[model samples]
Target: MIPQGPGEEDYGALSEQRKLVLATYDLCAVCALPFRDELRWQVTFDDQLQQMGETFAFNEAPVHEVCALYAAQVCPFVSSPHARLGDAQRKGQRRAETLTLAGFTHTATVFGHDSELQVGESILMFEMADLRRIHRLTGADDARSAYEAVLRDEARIELDDAERRVVDLLCAPTPKGEDSGPVMAGAAWFIGAVFCPQIRRVQAMKKFADAEGDLYFQLAANFLDNPEMMAEWEDSNDASTAAAMSWFRTRQSVPAVLQQWRADGARRVRDVRGRRPRAVGAAVVVPRDEAAIRRRRDAEAALRKARRRKR
Candidate 1:
């Protein structure tokens, strides 16, 4: 079933409850299915992107990469250049000439006060480190081009020397009866880079643990005991590993780690050649000022009036 709003299924407005479920479990908003190992995609307008500047949080839940492209090709408001964002909440807002389909590994759920000053609805926010692709589109043709580009990129993934070294370290067998701190650190990097989708963080961890056996658990315990080891991991050259450590430090137990991982997957690493480590997992609240609150209230009032007039 589609996400239900106040009265019925509203494709324009996502229910707050559904948003929570999607963010908490890392499910695709369109299909309501687990994301597993796939990259998460968010649709953004040029105006919205410009308004938010370099960093922005999305109120809408993320969709699968393919799902986002499919929606862009089929949804009238999204596919048509002449269409505008005509929902009651955002009336008269013209759609931007350029739409961006951003792919990322995971998103953090930001909770804060809404216009009414209550526990505000949760929204997904992510840092640049988590981003993998930023494909821009102007029409259905661009969606098809992007889909093709995705396939080409996936088929031709080429690891650089450093990345290859990291992979080799992760795949190397640990010496029997020895500590696995170094290898586990590499595992963290690999997981952050490769399989740490928001919907399957715990499953990935479980898989690695099962394969590595007692060594994995022992290293996890060591991190819990030393805690400082996590700090040392922050010094890792891999931007993704450093970001992952930021969230990992907060979780000390298996359950806590699993819950947080399911809530927000570790930040994926970006290319290291020209990139610097960026902060990750920070939460951003919506309607930061009084003007924004007033605008939201007016929108709701307008929507109610419109509904009554239609009836």
Candidate 2:
């Protein structure tokens, strides 16, 4: 039996009407973009249908018309910068196959952004990386074990309550074309990201700063000496300042800090002189708008003083 949306306590007890009401959300058509033509799914099940008695407990009553209720679409896939390009190229090179529910073989792709499942004999090891492909496999016990194995192995990120609720809603089984219900897709998306790996988010952030290298160190040094430059950002209302703040949220650090560090002639601990100098020269790189920073600082100081006086 097919599972309903993520929340049902027992899918098997649902009436036919309830079962028909569940919505299905497929990977394709998620964006609601118009396509030139419709796509179809092909399905085939195990030829040797043997029943293994007393070995399995069904979570949801089996549904015979699962394929008729669902369809799959293929979309263009991309890779993160942290990911090896060669691996992406190889995946792209592989012949894309169709997804069929009834088919003897199952076809799917794994992505850093998507949820993952581990497969194979290390039953319960839960980290198997290989994707299983088979021609003939059957039995309630076998199928239940396989599905349970997949769910048990599925890796998900922890999310706050609000975010997790949204994810739960998205995972709900819905009918075709009704997958994304009343909630704006954006909300659903934010929730999905909470439980998802966020591979792209990481890759995008890494691009803004030099991570894992000496360049980052050099930048950090620049910020240490010119601390005022970094602090000035808090007061500036300029578009550039706003842009900088936006970038920092994703990258999680201020570029001005690094700039100041470099200006102060800061160097790695190992590079320090045997006898440390009592003081170091400041190497400030002033842009044409240098005065704005100083003005912002003064303004803030005056504001604080005025607030204290009023109190």
* Per-prediction TM-score to the true structure, in the order listed: 0.41, 0.19
Residue 193 of candidate 1: its Cα lDDT?
19
User: lDDT tens digits, residues 140-251, model 2?
Assistant: 3333344455446544434333222223333343334333232222221111111112212322212223344534333333333333343444333532232222222222
After aligning candidate 1 to the native by TM-score, how far in Å is the CA of 198 from where it should be? 20
The segments of candidate 2 whose C-alpha lies over 4 angstroms from its true place after superposition are: 1-136, 148-157, 160-162, 168-180, 186-311
Expressed as tens digits, the lDDT of each residue in 1-311 for candidate 1 is 96645734232122443443344334567755545557778888776655766565675768878778877778565467675566797786655677788887766433322323223322223332267877788887888777676556543334433233323223233335322223343445232212223322221223443545445444434443344565555445543354345434443222222345422332221232234323332221222345543553454355446545756
- Per-candidate total of colliding backbone pairs: 0, 31
Instruction: Identify the leading candidate in terms of TM-score.
Output: 1
lDDT of 2: 0.27
Error (Å) of candidate 2 at residue 233 is 25
